[model samples]
Target chain A: MAKELLKGNVAMAEAAVRAGCEAYFGYPITPQTELLEHMAARMPELGRAFVQAESEVAAINMVYGAACTGKRVMTTSSSPGVSLMMEGISYIAGTEVPMVLIDVMRGGPGLGNIAPAQGDYTQMVHGGGHGDYKTIVLAPASVQEAIDLTALAFDLADKYRAIVVVLADGSLGQMMEPAELPEMQPLKKQLPDWAITGEPGRDRRLLTSIYLQPEDEETTNIRLQRRWMEIEANEVRYQEYFLDDAEIVLVGFGTAGRVALSAIRHARAEGIKVGLFRPVSLSPFPAEALRLVARKAKAMLVVEMNAGQMLNDVRLVTQGACPVDFYGRMGGVVPLPDEILSEIMRLARFTPHDLNGHTRAAWLDRLEVVRGAK
Target chain B: MVATDIQNAKLVYERPESLADVATHYCPGCTHGTAHRLVAEVLDEMGIREHSIGVASVGCSVFSYNYFDMDFVQAAHGRAPAMATGVKRVFPDRTVFTYQGDGDLASIGMAEIMHAAARGENITVIFINNAIYGMTGGQMAPTTLPGMKTTSSPRGRDVETQGYPIRMSEILATLDGVSYVVRRSLHNPAEIRKSKKAIRYAFETQQRGLGFSMVELLSSCPTNWGMTPLDSLTFIEDKMVPAFPLGDYKVIDAVKSMKWKEG
Candidate 1:
């Protein structure tokens, strides 16, 4: 395989087309417009439809329509555009149509600057759209991971028949790295019989969230829960670095995870015996795997780009098994490896004997205050 | 029985098998029945029952889909054009069109309708300009005439307080993408024949793969207009036609030259 240097945004767009994306629709938004422009310039050449919609609302609806035809499709946007897309996202989830959404997150509660921020961690992982639904969120740490994980997103979407979100930040989208492109399988000409192609040779098919009757709504929720359980059981993905006989663990995802790797190496060089537990899938979050790893470590320090967003997931999985502590930087700035290493050193003071006094249960009690609020 | 007899009569211009044989819920002498018959007859004539997809918008005629023997999707207020654009783009081989009233198309969905035409999307739009919000108890509409009185504008519309009626056909004709734009009224036999010609043009344009085409039919809401069916027709001819003049505003017929090609 020949290697080519590609920006994270370009790599993601190529992966989508290689994954058999038949249509691409998006509006230009900061920190992610490169992906839209690339598709606009490339999709026409590939004989695929590409539309620069009037607004984020229009772009997502175009995706919704294209997806309903059972074609592989996708859309890209940043935080503000993603917010506008939530309405259509909710509708897509309700109808159980599988597609890809890439949110290259920028900062803020409103019009935040065009810099990398992991502030949307909670929104992507915790069902930001209005409904009882979950998007399979994959957080890529580098430009290479951007390509690999985006290809994986298409497979996961088709396998589970659900939305797969590739959540990255400006650093990952704008940064350049060498990538080995993966070949896609041949595309399907005809959709599955289940698709609503005008009720021909079958009864009328309805794709809507509105269930006037209570029982019908209950049945839909139950079906969604069953699918969620299957995904949790079989599809949780994560990466562990230098975990043999470590006393401390640094937990993170996305760009923060890349920073934590350096902090883990620095802690090891100082004989601090710290490891990294980086989650690759943020939705079916590696909860059980983290719980088992928690038994081996004396403490876990979660370094994040936001004010303790992923900390909630850390607490949920660990149940305070190893005295989970959070080190965070809010808004658009990313924390440095030195800062994370200092936090690890600050957390490594506890001996195994220290676990005997406070206990994991007591630490869990303290963590729940924020967890419950979230 | 009257509806069934109308469906059977060739002089009445309807498709018995392709149209839902069930009786219409529309009030007696209302033009909604005529509009529905015209659409059904066109579908039958074109032999596109299998390929046509209808978009029903939020209005008194929202249930128009129930009477059409074809696939249908109901859209939110003023969103039929957008949804129809989606369907047509997804299935380029299939014919997709939206059936919308004045309140749905001209008022709430003005932006979507205008943009869809401007984009020159390959879809047909059947716009029924009844000049009133029929589903919501006769409110003033964008197509409602100046000095028109209704439940909302009870004291008669004032040019200062209320804006003048919008001419959608003229507005759409100014677009680069729209291949055909025509406005016709369904007041008398002669005008109904003209409206049919406009509708047939839109349907044929779709079949021949033309760019965006729209036929704006000036219809009547007799129940909301507080007039008998005969008087409502007179009102449409006397009042609505002059405000929304009858004519074909645009026709491109260059759809074949605009084919998608991979570089």
Candidate 2:
């Protein structure tokens, strides 16, 4: 099929529907509301389930319940709404049912503005809810990547019986771009053996998160940890640009990553040996690939819409192989390519031989300068 | 006895096939076991056991999945109503119900239950209102009587300060989406029978596509009440029934016209 102009939220909703999502339960929140609106209009026409829940708590539980029936189910929300959903998210993870969630991230910490931000990196990539569980986090920088990753989210969820999150920012959720959608997949007819369908000719199934026993709970944790190992081994995805013999590397994901790509191109045009590394899968993050890049580069600059969340992950993987500097825009601020281009230019000029770990002082100085100018 | 020997014997009384053979963890004299038995017998009578799914909520009823011999999932505290909505929407043909306690249904979960009923979801709900959070060791509940004493309300629930107890059945009845909503007691054999009938009606409401239906059973928690099992039953009859009252709170025309099932 030919590519058509599509908005990010609408494109993701369509991608989820085509990927055989049988049910959608959502509450209206800024940035991600368009995705829920699209589902509300389309799911019923296709004879599937769509429910507008009372809150994010209800939405995620509804997704949990629908998921237990061996159906493709999902919900979309923004930062504060996803925060409200953490309780149900932990329960869903505890139940070990497969479901999809889309976080169209906005500014955060609390009730932040509804603009582009990447503040949920730690929540999605690491543990947010209680327990030792792993969620597959996918960061899509553009409308096309959102479509592709949204489709893949369902497959990976089913393949592992885990939650898969499409972690996009407000800008990607609101922007329109030309993209080709995948062919619609037929919904699955056979329920998985572990599904709670309550149908005849099969033994009844019970799916619960409660173990009530320390030993039994340990076993459940062990199972989740074991499943996570297989995921880390097989599902590491990233894109490298102009990294051959480059001394300065730039790291980012989602909108920040997309912006960094532009900065890398501009710096390269100015005769700077700068490259870009964009991580798509943030949980089973492409650590091995970054290690290789760090081995060659003298310095790396991490850019984000938040104040250095994913930068920590990059620093961890790089492990002093290179000095990792950071530049970010927070609280609904979207950085321009030139802002990152300058950060690259700064890092290219001063190749720090030691770890640049005290980022707060530097970050505060920049924030103060900007606030003073305002 | 062997299968042949048992066939000749009278099967006057036995556990319902829908009820699991294992023992329940409910405290002695607690009416949750009785409530479970009534529901299992109702499911057996309807012959929907093979296609029934139960969502167990947090509290004393959280482990209800272990007592029902069918597909079951345990929900987070107070979210069973939303979970039941999801299950019912997915498998409309399957029998779906949530077993929740006072805290799970009337207090923290009020929004979920109210919305599910307002949406007229085609699902049944078995709400056990013991007036206290039994599993949490007797904290005051939304259904707790104004003067009833609990762990949290040791000085007795002061109506002037703590506010009055909520009548969920009465509140839910006002919603246009509900087809059947009623309050029943399990304090005696007669009331227990009545409660069972109400449960059957609730499930029938779902099977007939009549939208949401619920039966709020005033139950007893002997340990939490600090009384003997017998006294706890009397407490429900003497204190709870008078405070909460009982009767059909809501019944649509179709539900009222249906013949009562005695089986």
Clashing pairs in 2: none
Off by over 4 Å in 2: A370-374, B1-9, B260-263
DockQ of 1: 0.31
Give the Å shift of residue A66 in candidate 1: 1.1
Question: Highest lDDT: which candidate?
Answer: 2
lDDT per residue, candidate 1, B1-263, as tens digits?
Answer: 99998688776533544477888778887788787777777777767766777877788877876787776666656777776777677777788888999999998788778888989888899999999999888999988888999888998777798988889999999999898888888888888878776777787788777779999998989999999999999998889888888887886645323332211
lDDT of each: 0.82, 0.92
Query: Each model's RMSD to truth, in Å?
Result: 6.3, 1.8
TM-score of the first chain of model 1: 0.92
> What tens digits encode model 2's per-residue C-alpha lDDT throughout B1-263?
59889789886889998899999999999999999999999999998999899999999888999999999989999999999989988999999999999899988899999999999999999999998999889999998888889989899999888888999999999999999999999999999999998999999988889999999999999999899999988998889888889999999999988774556
User: Which tens-of-lDDT digit does each residue in A1-374 have in candidate 1?
Assistant: 57899988988998888888888889999899889988988888877888888877777777776666677889999998998888778877876777899999988768988989998988888977888999999999988788888888887887877899999999999989887888865676778655546645554444445554789988988998899999999889999998888888889999999999988888899998888999999989998899999988888878888877888778778775777777766678787888787677767764433444343355346445434654
